[model samples]
Target: MSELAVPAPSRHQLALMIWLAVFPTLTVLNLLLGGWLGDLPVVLRTFVLATIAVPIVVYGIVPRLHRLRARVLRGPHG
Candidate 1:
């Protein structure tokens, strides 16, 4: 039996998806953690944020977005 292949997102699409996941995540994290993160130096703060954000975006958000995109592309019947 044949299966429908969903093409991978293009560079632009991937960028947008990553941004869409990353932006809100970082924003909320900053809002929640700013008082604590504020004491850290600029580079350290950025590193800490990146470390926290990367896994959440990669393991959590991106997969959901990819699934959503596939569902959209497949339409309601799919």
Candidate 2:
């Protein structure tokens, strides 16, 4: 049997990637929902934010970041 050739990121790297993806997503969500969500209980607000942020982070931002990882890592010093 042939193995697939995909390279998996380490646990630390995956955490970093998720952090990068979630930060901006959560920021935007907070900005958009702040007024409406502010009155809600902390747990409920967090749940709503997570619900909206997860899909966007997983399906949208994370993939784009992975695709651009090399260039992003190169930075201005490169």
Candidate 3:
């Protein structure tokens, strides 16, 4: 019998998707927050801050944790 194979998301692919998702949200938030200039609402300002913050956290923190988990569970090759 043949074994069934499943596709998985590569690190790069996952990163790209995350980046894709982050970008639009950030852009909207950026526009909402005056797009790096002019006056804007407080809620929009907060959203803008969140947009910047979420990417940094994802790029820096989430990936690091994933790497650690991969190393422990699946070894460094992953």
Candidate 4:
């Protein structure tokens, strides 16, 4: 069987992809936690919260999954 390919990158393309993927959510989160700073319309807040949930789920879940994967990979002998 073949191994999965590691992700490859061009610096500019990678940077652009990351910013595009994450920027709007970050912006919304800032507003969610603020009053004057976040004085966004209600509709915008709804969209932001929905978008922000992705990273929130990843943040909450990824570390636990990472640790579990590490433990399994390392086995009991480690």
- Highest TM-score: which candidate? 1
Q: What lDDT would each prediction earn against the true structure?
A: 0.94, 0.83, 0.61, 0.57
* Model 1 worst lDDT run, 10 consecutive residues: 1-10
Indicate whether candidate 3 or candidate 4 has the larger TM-score.
3
The root-mean-square deviation over C-alpha atoms between each candidate and the true structure, in angstroms, is: 1.5, 5.7, 10.1, 10.3
After superposition, the stretches of candidate 1 with alpha carbons farther than 4 Å from their true spots are: 1-3
Task: Identify the candidate with maximal lDDT.
Answer: 1
For residues 1-78, could you state the per-residue lDDT of candidate 2 as single tens digits?
Answer: 543343566789889999999998999899999999999999999999999999999899989877666445655443
**Residue pairs in clash, model 2:** none
Off by over 4 Å in 3: 1-6, 35-48, 51-78
TM for every model, in the order presented, reads 0.93, 0.76, 0.39, 0.35
Write the residue-wise lDDT of candidate 3 on 17-71 in tens digits: 5776566666665676554645667786676578676976677655665555455
Relative to the unseen true structure, what is the Cα RMSD of model 2? 5.7
Candidate 3: pairs in clash:
none
- The TM-score, computed over Cα atoms with residue i paired to residue i, of candidate 4 is 0.35
Q: How close is candidate 3 to the true structure, as a TM-score?
A: 0.39
List the candidates ranked by lDDT, beginning with the highest.
1, 2, 3, 4
Report how far residue 28 has shifted in candidate 3, in Å. 0.4
For residues 20-46, write the lDDT of model 1, one tens digit per residue: 999999999999999999999999999
Q: Is candidate 3 or candidate 4 better by lDDT?
A: 3
If ranked by TM-score, best first, what sequence of candidates would result?
Answer: 1, 2, 3, 4
* Model 4 clashes, total count: 0
